[model samples]
Target: MKKKLISMLMIAAMAVSVAACGKSTPSETPSETPSETPSETPAEAKDPSEMTIYFLTKILGNQYWAVVEQGAKDAAKELGIKNLVVTGLASEAEVEKQVQQLQDAVAAQADAIVLGPVDSTAMANPVNDAHASGIPIVIVDTMINTENYDAALMTNNVQAGKDAAKEMIRLLEEKGVKKEEVAEVAIQIGSSGSQTIIDRLKGFYEYWDANAPQTWTVLRDDVKVNDGDISKAVGFTQDFLTAYPNLKGVFGPNNGSTVGFVTGLKEANRTDLVMVGFDFSTEIETMIREGKFNVSTVVQKQYLMGYEGVKQAVELAQGKKPATKLIDTGVLIVDLKNIDNDDVQSIIKPGK
Candidate 1:
């Protein structure tokens, strides 16, 4: 990353620290990480107070995105961005709605746009159009297919998947799950169009294949796609429990899918299955505390995604592109042992 951009983002990055569990990486202090050469260094960019920055999210009213929205709002307030418009579809499935929002941002002559794409491939053209119109784009949480954006900040999801798999292995070993035992693990995801979830799934599989016991396998035949619907996630959880008597573990790569695992496991009154997944929620917290089932989650620095995304946008608005186009905000592994640790608490329930 560029020297100036590093100076701009380091203070906030240092102030927030996310703790890790089960070999997951904690949030790192900003450093001069090497990345692609700077794309553009305009002689002059818009002033923060004169800029109308738009933060477009994947969905609203969801805890994960809600926190992200709050982070953007807080950054806008902190930086004194004159017009910060935060909006998104009510559901992650609304790719067309997000596309329209991007078009509107261009039509409105936005100074910059921070986006969480609903569909990675579908959103690329709209993002490219906005970029073509000279709107600096900073992507958060999810990725678009094109390379037109000014900066991107998100978790290293593939590594996160490997971390989740490692945690799952630990839990299974703790339960005396024999290495040679024929057991099945299932995978659940929210949106097939989301490269974020896709990368997480990829990481998990690659790691599991290389490291897991030969007899243990991911139930690829019945891998469930919830399409961002929590209800469907819950139903899929029930199906996994009912159909696979030898199911020893399951992985939920997003909030809804993980919550579904928690709820469905409880409803079935089954505690024999070890569950590893992503995100933080009350349901997940309660289950961890109850110790009814084995559970651990990979919690992304979502707040940082929004906060840093805006900072990146503001940098671009000021004619200084981020030194690095891609920033891995890192993640924390939260499980029963360290749920109450200060660093973990700060992320799972910030400002509490």
Candidate 2:
């Protein structure tokens, strides 16, 4: 009976040991029951909004700049850019005012700046500051001297000037003014410091040197500086009429000078003098239509300059480079002959 009892106790102990061995260890709580559906990757992030752009022109309230402003506005609306501040001084001579505007843009943390600099050299430091602050710059209409900018969109002034020279020669020839009979030709510039004007002058001289008759004189004194003032331009034009009685042709490379030239020529009844100028205005268009002075002018794609400048500025803001750093917007030579053509009309009336 004692042996049977001890065997029974051993059997019970073995059963307890077996039960303990069968119990499972805690296996990390089974790692959150792996979902049947695969985990999704997050979508790529989007570009931020509320991009503020500054379209700073050399001057405000001018017909040429008004068209440019319209182009910028059109682009801003198309791109969904919320803040596009188009601002500038009343005159291009206000270099300090432009510098202040640039500095203000920097202080306001503008995303990008599209500028038609008043003075290429004076605006360099402010542009440098804007660049240092990570704001991109797109120069338009007029060029700034620095390569630190993202893009430059402008009419090739040199080529435009050459075209003007050719037009002048053609008109002069039509007037029975032979190359040998060409007494003098003159140029009225808006500003001596303007790079655009300087380039135009260089182009005119280059063409003149290559093609103009040796007897045709370009008097150094006849190249007058009008300081971009229409009144000043008028004065200069009148002076040219008096100073060179045999003046055969004249080129005005800016709107102010061109307008002044037209006014002075009409006032002096010197409509026989061949004139080739830059830009177009109501007055200029009327002059061309009226057959005054056989005038032909180079019309820059101001609207394209503005449109492309904003486009490039926005692109740079969004971490993209323009297809080209320098975008030549192009120029058109308009006269009465082709003024009514669809293409010419488009250039003349850019807003249309």
Clashing residue pair totals per candidate (backbone < 3 A): 2, 0
Tens-digit lDDT track of model 2 for 1-352: 9999999999999999999878855454344533321222112211324788999987688888888988999899888888898888777688888888889998998989999988777787888888888898999988777777889999888888788888777888888887677468888887777788888888888887888788887776658877677888888888888878788888888888899998888888887788888998887898899975688889998988888788888778766677799989898889989889999888778767
Give model 2's TM-score versus the native structure: 0.85
Off by over 4 Å in 2: 1-49
User: What do the candidate models score in CA lDDT, each in turn?
Assistant: 0.86, 0.82
The local distance difference test score of model 1 is 0.86
Q: Which stretches of candidate 1 lie above 4 Å from their native place?
A: 1-45
Cα shift from native, residue 124, model 2 (Å): 2.3
lDDT of 1 by residue, 216-252 (tens): 9889877888877889999999898888889999899
- The candidate that wins on lDDT is 1
